[model samples]
Target: MHLLVTGFEPFGNDQFNASGEAVRLVPDKADGHRITKAILPVSFQRSGEVLAALLQDHQPDALICVGEAGGRDEISLEVQGANVDDARIPDNDGAQPVKQSIVRGGEDYRPATLDPEIILKALHQAGHGAYLSEDAGRFVCNRIAYLAYGQKVPALFIHVPALRPEGQKATVGAETDNREAALKAQPRTSCTLPELAEALTVVLASLADQMK
Candidate 1:
């Protein structure tokens, strides 16, 4: 079996993206399945384009796309993707799409083919902060999730937090200049990059068991 894992590059004022960093941390093999790592752009346009190409090239049995959601304190296993593209900030390409349909004449929304409940359970059993998220947001993560689900592929979108060591304050980059205030408002609830990598590995093992 083969699985394709993807993550997004850093965007905006973020110093580093945990998703991409974790993707790089995933081992080449998990439960006898080969893994392919891919880094996607933080653009609404290019992310989907690149994802489609990867699906074509790898033809993996499953796809797991990861992105950074700064405010979130836990790993979110998104259940569905909305057919909207409302960006709170401009993408890397300076494109801020609002009220835009991801696919013309497509369904309003699509649920991920993967079993989110199972994944959430596995993450929890592994002692990680994991939960099922109803919204994938109107960002590139949702766009790619919608695309992959539309292709009838078993896909999942995971939102991770910024890299932060245990017990230390997590300062997230904000679209506004009030970075310090934002950090103060949002508590320091995050995990290290290695911890996230372990969570992904557990996710893979759980998926492998489910497939069997």
Candidate 2:
């Protein structure tokens, strides 16, 4: 099976976005299925356009989009996307969408393809904490997660965190800028970039096995 994976460019409040690092490291670290990768601009306004282009360009058998869901501490497999858009924070373009569907009036939402039960089980067996997220959140993560299912291909959106680079804190900060605030407050995630890439490999390999 062919897998198209996406990770976002670092955006607001985050200096250590691991998604990009994870996706970039995939090809070198591990593989069973073909992994095509793309780095998404950190703008909600551009997400659909980029995703559409990717669908047209690669047309992979399965799509796994990874996004930084800052506050989450575990591997979260999103279950469903809310049709309505309500951004608690503005996107990279400074646009805040609220009370409107991701698609103004196109179609309803669909769930993820990687079995929540199966994938979560595997992650735990591999000694990585995991869970099923009720909300993908009303951000670009949700936007692409929603779009993936409508494409008639197996699709999933995995939310990762802003892991502290050296697994240590600055230990000296009086004021918290957006950067500092994100570092301490969101706590990114605990997993390393290399670990995430390995997990994606496991996911794709399992998916292919299930298909066979």
Candidate 3:
């Protein structure tokens, strides 16, 4: 099976995005399934456009969109995407949409075709912290999930917890800047980059088995 997996670029004041870094570590193949990976922009407008183009070009058997959820300690298997763009912060392009419909006349919500229960079980068996999430948030992550569900193939969004890079010191007391504050607020619960890659591989392998 061919799987198209996507991750977002670093946004805001952060130096790295967990999703992008983890996807970069993912192998080209998992359980005999071909994995095509792409790093998407954190733009509300262009992300969807790039994803649409990717879907058209690849036409893969499944699509998995991954994003970083800073405060979350576990890997989130999103079940639905809400058709709303309410960004608390500006995207990479400085676009901060407010309570706007992703597709003006679109449904209020779109359900992910991937089975969260199967994926969750696989993640647990692999010793990864994971859970089914109803909220993908109103950021670019949710936007990609919303657009992906509109596609022809099975699709879902996965949210990974923020990981602290090796050798980075914890901030003391008051934050020196917004970047420091953001970095300090992120939970350092997940394993290293290699482990994150392994977790994603487990997900892909499980999905491949399901297809068989």
lDDT of each: 0.79, 0.70, 0.82
| lDDT of residue 174 for candidate 2 | 11
Question: Candidate 3 on 1-212: residue-level lDDT in tens?
Answer: 89999998877777778788899888999978899999999999999999999989999999989987766667889899989987767888999888899999999999998888999999999899899988777878888989998888998899887675776522211111133344456455546778888889898998888778
Better of 1 and 2 by TM-score: 1
Where does model 3 exceed 4 Å of error? 167-186
| Candidate 1 lDDT by residue in tens digits, 7-115 | 9887776557788989999999997899999999988889888998999999988888987666667888888888888776688899988878998888998988989
In candidate 2, stretches whose alpha carbon ends up further than 4 angstroms from where it belongs are 28-31, 106-108, 167-185
TM-score order, best first, reads 3, 1, 2
Which candidate gets the maximum lDDT versus the true structure?
3
Please write out the lDDT profile of model 2 over residues 24-111, one tens digit for every residue: 8887323457778998876667987898899899888878888766656677788876565556566679887766787777666677
Ten contiguous residues minimizing lDDT sum, candidate 2: 170-179
C-alpha root-mean-square deviation, candidate 3: 4.6
TM-score of 1: 0.89
The CA lDDT at 114 in model 3 is 84
Residue 65 local lDDT, model 3: 91
Candidate 2 global Cα RMSD:
5.0
* Model 3 CA lDDT for position 1: 89
Work out the TM-score per prediction: 0.89, 0.84, 0.90
